[model samples]
Target: MTVESRRLDGNAAAGRLADVFAFDATVARTRCGGCGTTAPLGAHHVYADAPGMVVRCLVCEAVVLRIVRTPGHTWLDMSGTAALDIPDGDPS
Candidate 1:
Protein backbone atom coordinates (compact mmCIF):
# COMPACT_ATOMS: atom_id res chain seq x y z
CA MET A 1 0.00 0.00 0.00
CA THR A 2 1.28 3.42 -0.92
CA VAL A 3 1.31 5.83 1.98
CA GLU A 4 0.93 9.40 0.90
CA SER A 5 2.95 11.85 2.94
CA ARG A 6 0.80 14.78 1.91
CA ARG A 7 -0.96 16.01 4.99
CA LEU A 8 -4.70 16.44 5.10
CA ASP A 9 -6.96 17.53 7.91
CA GLY A 10 -8.68 14.61 9.61
CA ASN A 11 -12.19 15.58 8.55
CA ALA A 12 -11.21 16.28 4.98
CA ALA A 13 -9.16 13.11 4.71
CA ALA A 14 -11.94 11.03 6.21
CA GLY A 15 -14.48 12.64 3.89
CA ARG A 16 -12.33 11.98 0.87
CA LEU A 17 -11.88 8.38 1.92
CA ALA A 18 -15.60 7.97 2.45
CA ASP A 19 -16.31 9.37 -0.97
CA VAL A 20 -13.73 7.10 -2.52
CA PHE A 21 -15.12 4.06 -0.75
CA ALA A 22 -18.79 5.07 -1.14
CA PHE A 23 -19.48 4.39 2.50
CA ASP A 24 -22.02 6.23 4.62
CA ALA A 25 -19.86 5.95 7.71
CA THR A 26 -16.69 4.29 8.91
CA VAL A 27 -16.87 1.80 11.72
CA ALA A 28 -14.12 1.34 14.31
CA ARG A 29 -13.01 -2.06 15.49
CA THR A 30 -10.07 -2.87 17.71
CA ARG A 31 -8.33 -6.20 17.72
CA CYS A 32 -5.37 -7.69 19.52
CA GLY A 33 -2.58 -8.42 17.10
CA GLY A 34 -1.15 -11.06 19.42
CA CYS A 35 -4.30 -12.79 20.61
CA GLY A 36 -6.50 -11.98 17.57
CA THR A 37 -9.30 -10.87 19.84
CA THR A 38 -11.59 -8.14 18.56
CA ALA A 39 -13.87 -5.65 20.23
CA PRO A 40 -15.95 -2.62 19.45
CA LEU A 41 -13.98 0.62 19.50
CA GLY A 42 -14.80 4.29 19.75
CA ALA A 43 -13.21 7.38 18.37
CA HIS A 44 -10.06 8.40 20.15
CA HIS A 45 -10.02 11.42 22.42
CA VAL A 46 -8.06 13.33 19.81
CA TYR A 47 -8.71 11.59 16.53
CA ALA A 48 -7.02 14.32 14.55
CA ASP A 49 -3.67 13.15 15.84
CA ALA A 50 -1.87 10.10 14.48
CA PRO A 51 -1.89 8.14 17.71
CA GLY A 52 -5.52 9.05 18.24
CA MET A 53 -6.34 7.64 14.83
CA VAL A 54 -5.44 4.16 16.00
CA VAL A 55 -8.03 1.55 16.92
CA ARG A 56 -6.91 -0.42 19.91
CA CYS A 57 -8.37 -3.45 21.63
CA LEU A 58 -10.57 -2.65 24.59
CA VAL A 59 -9.07 -5.32 26.77
CA CYS A 60 -5.53 -4.77 25.58
CA GLU A 61 -4.28 -1.96 23.40
CA ALA A 62 -1.71 -4.29 21.97
CA VAL A 63 -2.93 -4.05 18.39
CA VAL A 64 -3.54 -0.79 16.60
CA LEU A 65 -5.28 -0.57 13.27
CA ARG A 66 -6.34 2.22 10.99
CA ILE A 67 -9.42 2.03 8.81
CA VAL A 68 -9.16 3.56 5.40
CA ARG A 69 -11.60 3.86 2.55
CA THR A 70 -10.96 2.34 -0.84
CA PRO A 71 -12.41 3.09 -4.22
CA GLY A 72 -14.98 0.31 -3.85
CA HIS A 73 -15.46 -0.20 -0.12
CA THR A 74 -14.04 0.34 3.33
CA TRP A 75 -11.01 -1.73 4.23
CA LEU A 76 -8.82 -2.48 7.20
CA ASP A 77 -5.21 -2.33 6.20
CA MET A 78 -4.12 -4.33 9.24
CA SER A 79 -6.59 -7.22 8.98
CA GLY A 80 -7.14 -7.05 5.21
CA THR A 81 -10.91 -7.02 5.67
CA ALA A 82 -13.04 -5.25 3.15
CA ALA A 83 -16.55 -4.14 3.97
CA LEU A 84 -17.85 -4.51 0.42
CA ASP A 85 -16.70 -4.62 -3.17
CA ILE A 86 -17.77 -1.79 -5.44
CA PRO A 87 -17.20 -1.53 -9.14
CA ASP A 88 -15.69 1.54 -10.67
CA GLY A 89 -18.04 4.06 -12.21
CA ASP A 90 -18.04 4.41 -15.95
CA PRO A 91 -16.84 7.69 -17.32
CA SER A 92 -19.09 7.54 -20.32
Candidate 2:
Protein backbone atom coordinates (compact mmCIF):
# COMPACT_ATOMS: atom_id res chain seq x y z
CA MET A 1 0.00 0.00 0.00
CA THR A 2 1.03 3.59 -0.56
CA VAL A 3 2.44 5.65 2.31
CA GLU A 4 -0.49 8.05 2.35
CA SER A 5 -2.99 5.28 2.83
CA ARG A 6 -1.64 4.26 6.22
CA ARG A 7 0.29 7.21 7.52
CA LEU A 8 -0.82 10.14 9.66
CA ASP A 9 0.60 12.60 12.15
CA GLY A 10 1.22 11.44 15.71
CA ASN A 11 -2.05 12.99 16.84
CA ALA A 12 -4.00 10.27 15.07
CA ALA A 13 -2.60 7.76 17.49
CA ALA A 14 -4.42 9.50 20.33
CA GLY A 15 -7.33 7.09 20.14
CA ARG A 16 -5.45 4.52 22.14
CA LEU A 17 -2.47 6.64 23.05
CA ALA A 18 -3.75 7.31 26.52
CA ASP A 19 -3.38 3.66 27.27
CA VAL A 20 0.34 4.03 26.91
CA PHE A 21 1.17 7.28 28.62
CA ALA A 22 -0.36 9.17 31.48
CA PHE A 23 0.88 12.51 30.22
CA ASP A 24 0.72 14.10 26.80
CA ALA A 25 3.10 11.91 24.90
CA THR A 26 2.99 14.20 21.90
CA VAL A 27 5.23 16.66 23.66
CA ALA A 28 7.74 14.03 24.63
CA ARG A 29 11.13 13.96 22.97
CA THR A 30 12.61 10.92 21.32
CA ARG A 31 15.86 10.29 19.49
CA CYS A 32 15.54 8.26 16.34
CA GLY A 33 17.78 5.21 16.35
CA GLY A 34 18.20 5.25 12.59
CA CYS A 35 19.27 8.87 12.07
CA GLY A 36 20.14 10.13 15.57
CA THR A 37 17.79 13.07 15.14
CA THR A 38 15.96 14.30 18.21
CA ALA A 39 12.45 15.70 17.93
CA PRO A 40 9.14 15.80 19.65
CA LEU A 41 7.08 12.68 19.25
CA GLY A 42 4.32 14.74 17.70
CA ALA A 43 6.55 15.55 14.78
CA HIS A 44 6.94 11.95 13.81
CA HIS A 45 4.74 9.94 11.46
CA VAL A 46 2.10 7.74 12.96
CA TYR A 47 0.50 4.96 11.01
CA ALA A 48 -2.59 4.18 13.06
CA ASP A 49 -4.48 2.51 10.27
CA ALA A 50 -2.44 -0.62 10.72
CA PRO A 51 -3.18 -3.36 13.26
CA GLY A 52 -1.33 -1.20 15.78
CA MET A 53 0.23 2.23 15.99
CA VAL A 54 3.56 2.70 14.22
CA VAL A 55 5.56 5.83 15.02
CA ARG A 56 8.30 6.65 12.56
CA CYS A 57 11.03 9.22 12.62
CA LEU A 58 10.51 12.27 10.48
CA VAL A 59 14.13 12.59 9.46
CA CYS A 60 14.84 8.98 8.59
CA GLU A 61 11.37 7.47 8.22
CA ALA A 62 12.51 4.74 10.54
CA VAL A 63 10.12 3.04 12.90
CA VAL A 64 10.60 4.70 16.28
CA LEU A 65 7.96 2.97 18.27
CA ARG A 66 5.10 0.50 17.98
CA ILE A 67 2.14 -0.08 20.28
CA VAL A 68 -0.15 -3.06 19.91
CA ARG A 69 -2.95 -4.11 22.19
CA THR A 70 -4.43 -7.51 22.79
CA PRO A 71 -7.39 -8.70 24.81
CA GLY A 72 -5.51 -8.55 28.08
CA HIS A 73 -2.17 -7.09 27.27
CA THR A 74 -0.72 -4.00 25.71
CA TRP A 75 2.51 -4.45 23.83
CA LEU A 76 5.05 -1.74 23.15
CA ASP A 77 8.21 -1.88 21.09
CA MET A 78 10.75 0.93 21.16
CA SER A 79 13.60 -0.80 19.42
CA GLY A 80 13.91 2.05 16.98
CA THR A 81 14.17 4.70 19.64
CA ALA A 82 17.63 5.41 20.88
CA ALA A 83 16.38 7.62 23.68
CA LEU A 84 13.05 8.74 25.06
CA ASP A 85 12.89 11.93 27.07
CA ILE A 86 9.72 12.51 28.97
CA PRO A 87 10.07 15.75 30.83
CA ASP A 88 8.79 16.56 34.25
CA GLY A 89 5.51 18.26 35.04
CA ASP A 90 4.79 21.92 34.42
CA PRO A 91 7.50 24.28 35.54
CA SER A 92 4.98 26.94 36.32
Candidate 3:
Protein backbone atom coordinates (compact mmCIF):
# COMPACT_ATOMS: atom_id res chain seq x y z
CA MET A 1 0.00 0.00 0.00
CA THR A 2 1.04 3.63 -0.40
CA VAL A 3 2.87 4.93 2.64
CA GLU A 4 0.43 7.78 3.21
CA SER A 5 -2.67 5.62 3.44
CA ARG A 6 -0.96 3.12 5.70
CA ARG A 7 1.25 5.35 7.79
CA LEU A 8 0.94 7.31 11.00
CA ASP A 9 3.86 8.25 13.30
CA GLY A 10 5.80 7.02 16.30
CA ASN A 11 3.46 8.85 18.65
CA ALA A 12 0.84 6.20 17.97
CA ALA A 13 3.11 3.51 19.35
CA ALA A 14 4.01 5.33 22.57
CA GLY A 15 1.66 3.48 24.88
CA ARG A 16 2.51 0.04 23.62
CA LEU A 17 6.23 0.79 23.71
CA ALA A 18 6.21 2.09 27.26
CA ASP A 19 6.22 -1.45 28.57
CA VAL A 20 9.25 -2.34 26.47
CA PHE A 21 11.43 0.75 26.51
CA ALA A 22 12.43 2.94 29.41
CA PHE A 23 12.93 6.00 27.28
CA ASP A 24 10.89 7.48 24.47
CA ALA A 25 11.71 4.95 21.81
CA THR A 26 10.50 7.37 19.19
CA VAL A 27 13.49 9.59 19.81
CA ALA A 28 15.87 6.86 18.85
CA ARG A 29 17.49 6.92 15.41
CA THR A 30 17.58 4.04 13.00
CA ARG A 31 18.74 3.33 9.47
CA CYS A 32 16.41 1.62 7.04
CA GLY A 33 18.03 -1.57 5.84
CA GLY A 34 16.02 -1.56 2.66
CA CYS A 35 17.15 1.85 1.43
CA GLY A 36 19.95 3.02 3.72
CA THR A 37 17.82 5.84 5.04
CA THR A 38 18.36 7.18 8.53
CA ALA A 39 15.89 8.98 10.77
CA PRO A 40 14.54 9.09 14.23
CA LEU A 41 11.77 6.72 15.09
CA GLY A 42 9.65 9.82 15.63
CA ALA A 43 10.15 10.84 12.03
CA HIS A 44 9.23 7.45 10.60
CA HIS A 45 5.70 6.58 9.56
CA VAL A 46 3.82 4.21 11.82
CA TYR A 47 0.84 1.99 11.15
CA ALA A 48 -1.21 1.09 14.20
CA ASP A 49 -4.58 0.11 12.78
CA ALA A 50 -3.45 -3.42 12.17
CA PRO A 51 -3.36 -6.18 14.79
CA GLY A 52 -0.02 -4.69 15.82
CA MET A 53 2.18 -1.68 15.19
CA VAL A 54 4.18 -1.26 11.99
CA VAL A 55 6.72 1.49 11.45
CA ARG A 56 7.87 2.19 7.92
CA CYS A 57 10.54 4.32 6.39
CA LEU A 58 9.40 7.74 5.25
CA VAL A 59 11.79 7.77 2.29
CA CYS A 60 11.76 4.19 1.03
CA GLU A 61 8.34 2.95 2.12
CA ALA A 62 9.91 -0.11 3.63
CA VAL A 63 9.15 -1.69 6.98
CA VAL A 64 11.46 -0.36 9.67
CA LEU A 65 9.87 -1.59 12.83
CA ARG A 66 7.00 -3.81 13.99
CA ILE A 67 5.45 -4.67 17.31
CA VAL A 68 2.85 -7.26 18.20
CA ARG A 69 1.35 -7.37 21.66
CA THR A 70 0.01 -10.74 22.64
CA PRO A 71 -1.97 -11.51 25.76
CA GLY A 72 1.12 -12.87 27.45
CA HIS A 73 3.90 -10.88 25.81
CA THR A 74 4.81 -8.25 23.30
CA TRP A 75 6.81 -9.09 20.21
CA LEU A 76 9.06 -6.43 18.74
CA ASP A 77 10.94 -6.82 15.48
CA MET A 78 13.42 -4.38 13.95
CA SER A 79 14.91 -6.54 11.27
CA GLY A 80 14.04 -4.05 8.57
CA THR A 81 16.29 -1.46 10.17
CA ALA A 82 19.94 -1.72 9.30
CA ALA A 83 21.03 0.06 12.44
CA LEU A 84 19.33 1.46 15.49
CA ASP A 85 20.86 4.18 17.64
CA ILE A 86 18.90 4.46 20.83
CA PRO A 87 20.36 7.10 23.09
CA ASP A 88 20.64 6.36 26.75
CA GLY A 89 18.08 8.18 28.84
CA ASP A 90 15.45 7.80 31.53
CA PRO A 91 12.26 9.57 30.50
CA SER A 92 10.54 8.66 33.72
Candidate 4:
Protein backbone atom coordinates (compact mmCIF):
# COMPACT_ATOMS: atom_id res chain seq x y z
CA MET A 1 0.00 0.00 0.00
CA THR A 2 1.13 3.57 -0.74
CA VAL A 3 -0.09 6.90 0.60
CA GLU A 4 0.42 10.35 -0.82
CA SER A 5 -0.47 13.65 0.84
CA ARG A 6 -0.20 17.33 0.01
CA ARG A 7 -0.27 20.26 2.36
CA LEU A 8 -0.24 24.02 1.98
CA ASP A 9 0.81 26.35 4.77
CA GLY A 10 -0.43 29.91 5.35
CA ASN A 11 2.46 31.43 3.43
CA ALA A 12 1.86 29.06 0.55
CA ALA A 13 -1.81 29.93 0.42
CA ALA A 14 -1.01 33.62 0.58
CA GLY A 15 1.48 33.17 -2.23
CA ARG A 16 -1.13 31.53 -4.40
CA LEU A 17 -3.54 34.36 -3.72
CA ALA A 18 -0.83 36.84 -4.60
CA ASP A 19 -0.18 35.04 -7.85
CA VAL A 20 -3.88 35.07 -8.74
CA PHE A 21 -4.25 38.73 -7.90
CA ALA A 22 -0.94 39.72 -9.44
CA PHE A 23 -1.04 42.09 -12.41
CA ASP A 24 1.11 42.08 -15.51
CA ALA A 25 3.79 44.72 -15.26
CA THR A 26 4.22 45.15 -19.01
CA VAL A 27 0.61 46.30 -19.42
CA ALA A 28 0.49 48.50 -16.34
CA ARG A 29 1.20 52.25 -16.39
CA THR A 30 -0.53 55.40 -15.16
CA ARG A 31 -0.14 59.18 -14.86
CA CYS A 32 -1.30 61.23 -11.92
CA GLY A 33 -4.14 63.51 -12.95
CA GLY A 34 -3.63 65.69 -9.88
CA CYS A 35 0.16 65.82 -9.85
CA GLY A 36 0.80 65.43 -13.58
CA THR A 37 3.47 62.82 -12.91
CA THR A 38 4.03 59.63 -14.90
CA ALA A 39 4.89 56.36 -13.14
CA PRO A 40 4.07 52.73 -12.72
CA LEU A 41 0.52 52.20 -11.47
CA GLY A 42 -0.76 49.82 -8.86
CA ALA A 43 -3.24 47.08 -9.70
CA HIS A 44 -6.51 47.16 -7.84
CA HIS A 45 -9.35 44.65 -7.84
CA VAL A 46 -12.53 46.61 -8.14
CA TYR A 47 -16.01 45.92 -9.47
CA ALA A 48 -16.32 44.02 -12.71
CA ASP A 49 -18.04 46.87 -14.58
CA ALA A 50 -15.64 49.61 -13.68
CA PRO A 51 -14.46 51.37 -16.88
CA GLY A 52 -10.91 51.05 -15.69
CA MET A 53 -8.67 51.36 -12.63
CA VAL A 54 -6.91 54.33 -11.17
CA VAL A 55 -3.13 54.09 -10.77
CA ARG A 56 -1.64 56.00 -7.89
CA CYS A 57 1.41 58.21 -8.23
CA LEU A 58 4.43 56.99 -6.31
CA VAL A 59 5.34 60.48 -5.19
CA CYS A 60 1.92 61.92 -4.44
CA GLU A 61 -0.45 58.95 -4.23
CA ALA A 62 -2.68 60.69 -6.74
CA VAL A 63 -4.43 58.85 -9.54
CA VAL A 64 -1.89 59.11 -12.33
CA LEU A 65 -3.50 56.96 -14.99
CA ARG A 66 -6.36 54.62 -15.79
CA ILE A 67 -6.01 51.16 -17.33
CA VAL A 68 -8.81 48.97 -18.62
CA ARG A 69 -8.68 45.33 -19.54
CA THR A 70 -10.86 44.56 -22.52
CA PRO A 71 -11.62 41.48 -24.59
CA GLY A 72 -8.45 41.58 -26.73
CA HIS A 73 -5.85 43.63 -24.90
CA THR A 74 -5.21 46.15 -22.16
CA TRP A 75 -5.95 49.76 -22.95
CA LEU A 76 -4.04 52.65 -21.47
CA ASP A 77 -6.34 55.66 -21.33
CA MET A 78 -4.52 58.86 -20.62
CA SER A 79 -5.92 61.73 -18.67
CA GLY A 80 -7.02 63.88 -21.62
CA THR A 81 -7.31 61.29 -24.35
CA ALA A 82 -10.52 59.60 -25.40
CA ALA A 83 -8.74 56.91 -27.39
CA LEU A 84 -7.18 53.84 -25.81
CA ASP A 85 -4.13 51.95 -26.99
CA ILE A 86 -4.40 48.18 -26.97
CA PRO A 87 -1.30 46.42 -25.78
CA ASP A 88 -0.27 42.88 -26.72
CA GLY A 89 -1.36 39.84 -24.70
CA ASP A 90 -4.13 39.37 -22.11
CA PRO A 91 -4.40 42.37 -19.76
CA SER A 92 -5.77 40.32 -16.94
Candidate 5:
Protein backbone atom coordinates (compact mmCIF):
# COMPACT_ATOMS: atom_id res chain seq x y z
CA MET A 1 0.00 0.00 0.00
CA THR A 2 1.05 3.58 -0.45
CA VAL A 3 2.67 5.28 2.51
CA GLU A 4 0.03 7.97 2.43
CA SER A 5 -2.77 5.46 2.79
CA ARG A 6 -0.97 3.44 5.43
CA ARG A 7 -0.03 6.19 7.81
CA LEU A 8 -1.46 8.93 9.95
CA ASP A 9 0.17 11.64 11.99
CA GLY A 10 1.77 10.54 15.25
CA ASN A 11 -0.95 12.18 17.30
CA ALA A 12 -3.03 9.07 16.74
CA ALA A 13 -0.68 7.07 18.95
CA ALA A 14 -0.78 9.41 21.91
CA GLY A 15 -3.49 7.55 23.78
CA ARG A 16 -1.75 4.20 23.57
CA LEU A 17 1.55 5.75 24.57
CA ALA A 18 -0.05 7.32 27.64
CA ASP A 19 -0.38 3.86 29.12
CA VAL A 20 3.40 3.58 29.16
CA PHE A 21 4.60 7.14 29.55
CA ALA A 22 3.57 9.39 32.38
CA PHE A 23 3.81 12.43 30.21
CA ASP A 24 2.59 13.36 26.75
CA ALA A 25 4.94 11.32 24.63
CA THR A 26 3.83 12.94 21.43
CA VAL A 27 5.43 16.22 22.47
CA ALA A 28 8.82 14.60 22.64
CA ARG A 29 11.38 15.39 19.96
CA THR A 30 13.17 12.59 18.19
CA ARG A 31 16.09 12.46 15.83
CA CYS A 32 16.00 9.97 13.00
CA GLY A 33 18.91 7.56 12.79
CA GLY A 34 18.50 7.24 9.06
CA CYS A 35 18.32 10.90 8.05
CA GLY A 36 19.25 12.87 11.16
CA THR A 37 16.09 14.96 10.81
CA THR A 38 14.84 16.11 14.19
CA ALA A 39 11.20 16.79 14.97
CA PRO A 40 8.48 16.27 17.49
CA LEU A 41 7.25 12.70 17.78
CA GLY A 42 3.76 13.87 16.90
CA ALA A 43 5.07 15.14 13.60
CA HIS A 44 6.16 11.75 12.37
CA HIS A 45 4.20 9.16 10.47
CA VAL A 46 2.27 6.50 12.35
CA TYR A 47 0.75 3.24 11.17
CA ALA A 48 -1.71 1.84 13.67
CA ASP A 49 -3.68 -0.69 11.69
CA ALA A 50 -1.12 -3.41 12.15
CA PRO A 51 -0.79 -5.75 15.10
CA GLY A 52 0.81 -2.79 16.83
CA MET A 53 1.89 0.76 16.19
CA VAL A 54 4.78 1.71 13.90
CA VAL A 55 6.19 5.25 14.03
CA ARG A 56 8.35 6.41 11.19
CA CYS A 57 10.67 9.29 10.60
CA LEU A 58 9.31 12.27 8.71
CA VAL A 59 12.27 12.56 6.39
CA CYS A 60 13.67 9.13 5.70
CA GLU A 61 10.63 6.95 6.33
CA ALA A 62 12.69 4.85 8.70
CA VAL A 63 11.08 3.13 11.60
CA VAL A 64 11.71 5.32 14.60
CA LEU A 65 9.51 3.67 17.13
CA ARG A 66 7.47 0.52 17.45
CA ILE A 67 5.09 -0.63 20.16
CA VAL A 68 3.26 -3.88 20.39
CA ARG A 69 0.88 -4.85 23.13
CA THR A 70 -0.04 -8.35 24.10
CA PRO A 71 -2.38 -9.66 26.75
CA GLY A 72 0.42 -9.57 29.32
CA HIS A 73 3.01 -7.21 27.97
CA THR A 74 3.81 -4.15 25.94
CA TRP A 75 6.88 -4.22 23.74
CA LEU A 76 8.61 -1.02 22.72
CA ASP A 77 11.50 -0.66 20.31
CA MET A 78 13.19 2.56 19.31
CA SER A 79 16.23 1.29 17.48
CA GLY A 80 15.76 3.73 14.60
CA THR A 81 15.80 6.78 16.82
CA ALA A 82 19.14 8.42 17.34
CA ALA A 83 17.94 10.69 20.10
CA LEU A 84 14.81 11.61 22.03
CA ASP A 85 13.99 14.72 24.02
CA ILE A 86 10.99 14.45 26.27
CA PRO A 87 9.56 17.60 27.75
CA ASP A 88 9.51 17.80 31.52
CA GLY A 89 6.20 19.68 31.51
CA ASP A 90 7.82 22.77 32.83
CA PRO A 91 6.36 26.08 31.79
CA SER A 92 9.83 27.38 31.11
Candidate 6:
Protein backbone atom coordinates (compact mmCIF):
# COMPACT_ATOMS: atom_id res chain seq x y z
CA MET A 1 0.00 0.00 0.00
CA THR A 2 1.02 3.58 -0.49
CA VAL A 3 2.39 5.69 2.32
CA GLU A 4 -0.76 7.75 2.34
CA SER A 5 -2.82 4.65 3.02
CA ARG A 6 -0.74 3.95 6.08
CA ARG A 7 -0.68 7.48 7.33
CA LEU A 8 -2.00 8.05 10.79
CA ASP A 9 -0.56 10.19 13.56
CA GLY A 10 0.61 9.18 16.99
CA ASN A 11 -2.48 10.51 18.70
CA ALA A 12 -4.43 7.63 17.24
CA ALA A 13 -2.30 5.26 19.23
CA ALA A 14 -3.15 6.71 22.61
CA GLY A 15 -5.78 4.14 23.55
CA ARG A 16 -3.69 1.20 22.44
CA LEU A 17 -0.60 2.51 24.20
CA ALA A 18 -2.52 3.18 27.39
CA ASP A 19 -2.78 -0.55 27.86
CA VAL A 20 0.98 -0.99 28.11
CA PHE A 21 2.35 2.37 29.04
CA ALA A 22 1.75 4.52 32.07
CA PHE A 23 2.51 7.86 30.48
CA ASP A 24 1.86 9.25 27.02
CA ALA A 25 3.80 6.92 24.74
CA THR A 26 3.59 9.39 21.90
CA VAL A 27 6.24 11.38 23.67
CA ALA A 28 8.56 8.45 24.24
CA ARG A 29 11.81 7.90 22.38
CA THR A 30 12.50 4.86 20.24
CA ARG A 31 15.28 3.58 18.04
CA CYS A 32 14.29 2.01 14.76
CA GLY A 33 16.04 -1.26 14.13
CA GLY A 34 15.37 -1.01 10.43
CA CYS A 35 17.04 2.32 9.88
CA GLY A 36 18.95 2.75 13.14
CA THR A 37 17.26 6.10 13.48
CA THR A 38 16.05 7.46 16.77
CA ALA A 39 13.07 9.73 17.08
CA PRO A 40 10.13 10.62 19.24
CA LEU A 41 7.09 8.39 18.88
CA GLY A 42 5.07 11.29 17.52
CA ALA A 43 7.43 11.46 14.60
CA HIS A 44 6.79 7.89 13.64
CA HIS A 45 4.01 7.00 11.26
CA VAL A 46 1.25 5.38 13.24
CA TYR A 47 -1.60 3.42 11.63
CA ALA A 48 -4.35 2.67 14.09
CA ASP A 49 -7.36 2.10 11.87
CA ALA A 50 -6.11 -1.25 10.66
CA PRO A 51 -6.87 -4.56 12.31
CA GLY A 52 -4.06 -3.67 14.68
CA MET A 53 -1.95 -0.64 15.41
CA VAL A 54 1.25 -0.28 13.35
CA VAL A 55 4.11 2.16 13.83
CA ARG A 56 6.51 2.68 10.95
CA CYS A 57 9.88 4.30 10.61
CA LEU A 58 9.79 7.57 8.72
CA VAL A 59 13.24 7.08 7.31
CA CYS A 60 12.93 3.56 5.99
CA GLU A 61 9.22 2.99 6.00
CA ALA A 62 9.82 -0.18 7.95
CA VAL A 63 7.54 -1.21 10.69
CA VAL A 64 8.98 -0.27 14.04
CA LEU A 65 6.14 -1.39 16.23
CA ARG A 66 2.76 -3.11 16.20
CA ILE A 67 0.05 -3.78 18.76
CA VAL A 68 -2.66 -6.39 18.53
CA ARG A 69 -5.32 -6.73 21.13
CA THR A 70 -6.94 -10.06 21.79
CA PRO A 71 -9.94 -10.74 23.89
CA GLY A 72 -7.78 -12.04 26.69
CA HIS A 73 -4.66 -9.92 26.24
CA THR A 74 -2.78 -7.41 24.19
CA TRP A 75 0.23 -8.32 22.08
CA LEU A 76 2.99 -5.91 21.24
CA ASP A 77 5.56 -6.56 18.56
CA MET A 78 8.73 -4.54 18.70
CA SER A 79 10.91 -6.63 16.47
CA GLY A 80 11.56 -3.63 14.26
CA THR A 81 12.70 -1.53 17.18
CA ALA A 82 16.15 -1.65 18.68
CA ALA A 83 15.33 0.17 21.90
CA LEU A 84 12.48 2.07 23.46
CA ASP A 85 12.97 4.62 26.19
CA ILE A 86 9.88 5.37 28.13
CA PRO A 87 10.59 8.26 30.45
CA ASP A 88 10.31 7.58 34.14
CA GLY A 89 7.78 10.28 34.84
CA ASP A 90 7.69 12.17 38.16
CA PRO A 91 8.87 10.08 41.08
CA SER A 92 5.77 10.97 42.98
| Candidate number achieving the greatest lDDT relative to the actual structure | 5
TM-score of each: 0.33, 0.86, 0.84, 0.30, 0.90, 0.83
Off by over 4 Å in 5: 1-3
Computed on alpha carbons, the lDDT of every model, listed in order, comes to: 0.39, 0.86, 0.85, 0.38, 0.91, 0.85
Candidates sorted by TM-score, best first: 5, 2, 3, 6, 1, 4
Q: Tell me, by TM-score, which candidate is best.
A: 5
Better of 1 and 2 by lDDT: 2
Residue 66 in model 6: shift from native, Å? 0.5
Error of 1 at 35 (Å): 2.7
Residue lDDT tens for model 5, 1-92: 88688689999889888989988989999999999999999999999988889999988889999999999999999899999898789887
Residue pairs with clashing backbones, model 1:
none
Per residue, candidate 6 scores C-alpha lDDT tens digits across 1-92 of 98698588766777788889879888888899988999878788887768888988978879988999989999999899899888878799
Q: After superposition, how far is residue 91 of candidate 3 from its true place, in Å?
A: 11
Q: Compared with the true structure, what per-residue lDDT tens digits does model 4 show for residues 19-49?
A: 3335444233444456555433333111222
lDDT of 2 by residue, 1-92 (tens): 89776678877766566787997788789999999999988889998867888999988899999999999999999999999898897989
Q: State the lDDT of candidate 1 residue by residue for 25-72, as single tens digits.
A: 234343445455543333311133453244434343443445554466
- Model 2 clash pairs? none
Give the per-residue Cα lDDT of candidate 3 at 91.
62
In angstroms, how far off is 15's CA in candidate 2? 3.9
RMSD of 5: 1.9
RMSD per candidate (Å) reads 10.7, 1.9, 2.9, 13.9, 1.9, 2.4
Error of 5 at 56 (Å): 0.3
Report the candidate with higher lDDT, 1 versus 4: 1
**Candidate 4 TM-score versus the reference:** 0.30
- For model 1, the superposed segments whose C-alpha errors exceed 4 Å read 1-31, 43-48, 67-76, 79-92
- Pairs of residues at least 3 apart in sequence or in different chains that clash in candidate 6: none
